[model samples]
Target: MYQAFYGLREMPFSLTPNTEFMVRLPGHQECLNLLLVALEQGEGFIKISGEVGTGKTLLCRALLNSLDAERFQLAYVPNPCLTPEGLRRAVARELRLVEADSLGEIALLEAINQKLIELAHAGRSCVLLIDEAQALPDDTLEALRLLTNLETERSKLLQVVLFGQPELDDVLGQERFRQLRQRITFSYRLKQLEGEQIERYLNHRLSVAGYNGPALFERAALRLLAQGTRGVPRLINIVAHKALMVGFGKGQRRIPRSFVQRALDDTEGVQGPANAQPRWPWGVAAGLVVALTLWQAPALLNWLQPWLPTVANAEQGGGDESGQ
Candidate 1:
């Protein structure tokens, strides 16, 4: 609703994992680089885990777009919430094994193996990318490990990359999963964006969405946003979009901290670094947080001195208009 008024071609903060809105956050870029290198080295199992909304899926898609299609036959199974047999057929469908849906569990396994080998022989490698893999059934996960066991004398024929939440780590840490855990040759954990990174993230998204106006979020607004969302991009986007709506509804051009706080208050289940600060403490002190942190101590002291009737510059005729 606010797009045209704000000079944006689209809602920059939409929660969809649009690759076009992707920003080169350091953590994400590093994860992507490691994934490329690991896949190139023929690692059998690679894992990427992070808290909810930390961009695991976005990074997964970025990796997909980065890979050269001719050299790699890519199969994506989003949320593998299926039984072992179902999981096998899901993967087979992605790998283009049309007959897999009708095959028995054992036969499906063989077909998947043959498909991987077929791709390997054609000067191409096969990769299975599963999103939200923490939800994969125990038996299905074991099936995945079995699939990776198919290999030539040189390297494995299939490579698997799992993108999931932090619980995946917990699930894999179980003693029963020792073998599967051990086989994860490479893994990377995604971190939430830091304060400074959030500013760039917002700006990049805005720019990509065709925002040519002045800065959309004011400094204090940005600070509160960083704190309130604790730098999680999805939360940041949700809160930001709401803040813009708050601004637009009020016919305000720029977003302020109060607008962000309103957004935070209206939203629920926000693991809320977002607790609404009370009137006394926040009204009296929160506004100074940015200035205190941003200014050098000496400069801040110097700036304060001019307002104080202290001796450092008292004799320089500084405090009063009439030097009284």
Candidate 2:
């Protein structure tokens, strides 16, 4: 709805991962470069960790899209909340091996190994990318560790990249998966975007979506957004989206502080940090709310009077006369 007003060909703030709109912030670029180099070296058990809404999934998708097709064979499993058997089955399906159900556990592993060897012989490297891997059960993670055992004499046959929230780090720290944790050849932590990066990121998305207008976000509003969202990409998208809506509603061309404030008020769970100060005092705010309620009650009741039955109206009328 705000696209036309803002001159955007598409929704710039969409939550879905779009490689076309990927922004190369310094941290993100460095992480991407590291992952690319690590994958090229045929490393097994790579991991990328980030805070929630820090764009881990987006980075995963971008990596998948970034690789050259003939050189890299990629299979992506977005949600990895599965049992050991289920996780293996997902990997089997991703590799397009038939008879996955008929094969027993050992046989399934052998089949996947064979497929990886065949792909390697065909001059293609296989990569399995798992997102939201923090939810993987301990047993399932162990199973993944075993899968990494499939290797040629020189290097691994299959490479795996886990993209997940910070909880994945905690999960990896457990004693049971020490072997798997040790196998992580390449790891990167995605930091939240900085103020300047946030501006560049938003503008990059807008430009990718074919927006060619004046600056949409004012300097003050952008700073406010950066502070409010702590520079998390997804949160920045949400607040910016709502702020654009508010700007459109107010018939404004550029986002202002008021528009951003209204956007913050409308979004749930976008509350400021615990240490954040309220724009007004608690006592004054409470008093104003109570005063407004009391002041508007009579008008609200009067507006609803016509919808009430005659008896209800009569009761209201009697109450009013008695009060008078």
Candidate 3:
């Protein structure tokens, strides 16, 4: 709604995982690099974990887009909560092996293996990318492990990459999953952007969204934004988007600190400094106290006059030195 006011062609702070708006911060870039390298080496099992809203899905999409179709046969399973048999069918569908859908569980496995062999002979490597894999049933996970066992004389036939939240780590650490965990040759954890990186990320998204004006967000506002969202890209996008809308609503071009605060207050999981009670700075309060004391000093002395010597005694003392 505020795009035109800000001279932006599209929403810069959209939460959608648009590859065009992707900002390759250190962590994300490293994760992508590791994935590409591991896939190139035909690693059996690769895992990537991150907190919610940390861009695991974006990274998954980025990886999918990065791979060359000529060299890789990709199968993506976005939901992994299926039973072992169900998961096999999902994998079969992703691989476009329609015949596997008609077969029994054992027959399905054999069909998938044959398909992988055929792909391998054709100079294409088969890769299964599972997102939200933490929700996968234990039996389903074991099925995945077994899928990796389908191999030729030289190397494994199917390679798998799992993208999931941190709970995935806990699930994999269980004794029942030790075998599958052992097969993970490569792993990378996605992280939220650092303070400095947040600024760059914002600018990158704005530029990608076709914004060329001067910085839309004031520096202080941006700082609060980084603090509020704790550098999580999705949260930053949410808060920033609201701030822009606030600025637009006020017919202002630049997003100010107050606007950012408003945005933070409306967003969930954003604990900005503004949420706390306001307090005066110690230095400022001290200076104010000193100024007040000086201004009221005469009045304070007049108020204490009743406890001082009378005027008659004061005059006698004044004349004592002359002794007239």
Candidate 4:
């Protein structure tokens, strides 16, 4: 809504993992580099853990996009909350192997192994990525570990990467999963962006959306964003979009602290002493401005367009009209 008013070509704060908007902050870029190195080394089990909104999904998408398809056959399972048999079938579907819900566990294993062998003979690496893997049941997690056993003499034919919240570490710590946990040759903990990185992140996103302005957000506004959102990119997006609406609502030339404060209140899950503050009257003014701008921008632009030519003609003192 504030895109045109702010001179941005698109919404800069959307939650979708558009790799095009990816800003290579230090932590994220390091994680990406490590993942590539591990994959290239043919590591059998790799894991990445992060808080819920710390861009794990985005990183996962980035990894998938970066992989060379000619050398690696990719199998991605987005949801891993399934029984052992169900998990096998999910992996099978990803590999485009025949669906074998009717086959028992042993038969399913044989089929998957045979398929891996076939891929190896063709000189392709089979790689599996499982997201939200903390939800995988013990049996299913063990099944995944066993799947990694599909190997040849040259190098392990199968490689797997698991992305999940920190609960995955708790799951891996269980004695039953000790073997799988030990097999993870590479792992990284994703951290949220810090103060300066947050500023760069917002600017990068806006620039990607074709925004070229004197900086729209003031220092106080950015400080509030870092305080209230705690540097989580998702939270930053939510607060920043609302703050833009707040700025547009108030007819403010630049985003101020009040805009971000109103956004803090608007957030559903983040109300606490850290963010809670007495409502300011300018917050309401901003909303009114937003409403008025929405109601007036179209009519105002339309009324201005036709008059441009008439104004130019009048300025030129048209010979016919002036009767010179």
Write one digit per residue (lDDT tens) for candidate 4, span 229-324.
Answer: 878889988888888887877667598887778888777545455356547545534695657768898887787998889888887887666786
Clashes of 1: 0
Best model number under lDDT? 3
lDDT of 1 by residue, 1-324 (tens): 678778889999998899999999888999999999998888999999999999999999999999999988999998789887887788889898889778887888888888888888898888899999999988888888888889999989989999999999888998889999999999999998988899999999999999987998999999988877888999999888878776766667788888788777666545455655433443323333443446467787777876676665665656565765
Screening candidate 2 with a backbone cut-off below 3 angstroms (N, C-alpha, C), the clashing residue pairs are none
Global lDDT scores for all candidate models: 0.85, 0.83, 0.86, 0.85
Query: How do the residues 271-316 of candidate 2 rate in per-residue lDDT, one tens digit apiece?
Result: 4751254344432134334544575888877877777788787899
lDDT of 3 at 70: 100
Alpha-carbon lDDT of model 1: 0.85
Q: Is candidate 2 or candidate 4 better by TM-score?
A: 4
Best by TM-score: 4
lDDT accuracy of residue 185 in candidate 3: 97
lDDT-based ranking? 3, 4, 1, 2
Error of 4 at 65 (Å): 0.4
For model 4, the local distance difference test gives 0.85
Give the candidate order by descending TM-score: 4, 2, 3, 1
Better model by lDDT: candidate 3 vs candidate 4:
3
Task: Give each model a TM-score.
Answer: 0.83, 0.84, 0.84, 0.85
What's every prediction's RMSD, in angstroms? Answer: 14.4, 6.0, 14.9, 10.4
Candidate 4 ranges beyond 4 A from true positions: 99-104, 271-274, 277-324
**By TM-score, how accurate is candidate 4?**
0.85
Candidate 3 at residue 20, lDDT? Answer: 86
> Could you tell me how far off, in angstroms, the CA of residue 224 lies in candidate 4 after the best superposition?
1.4
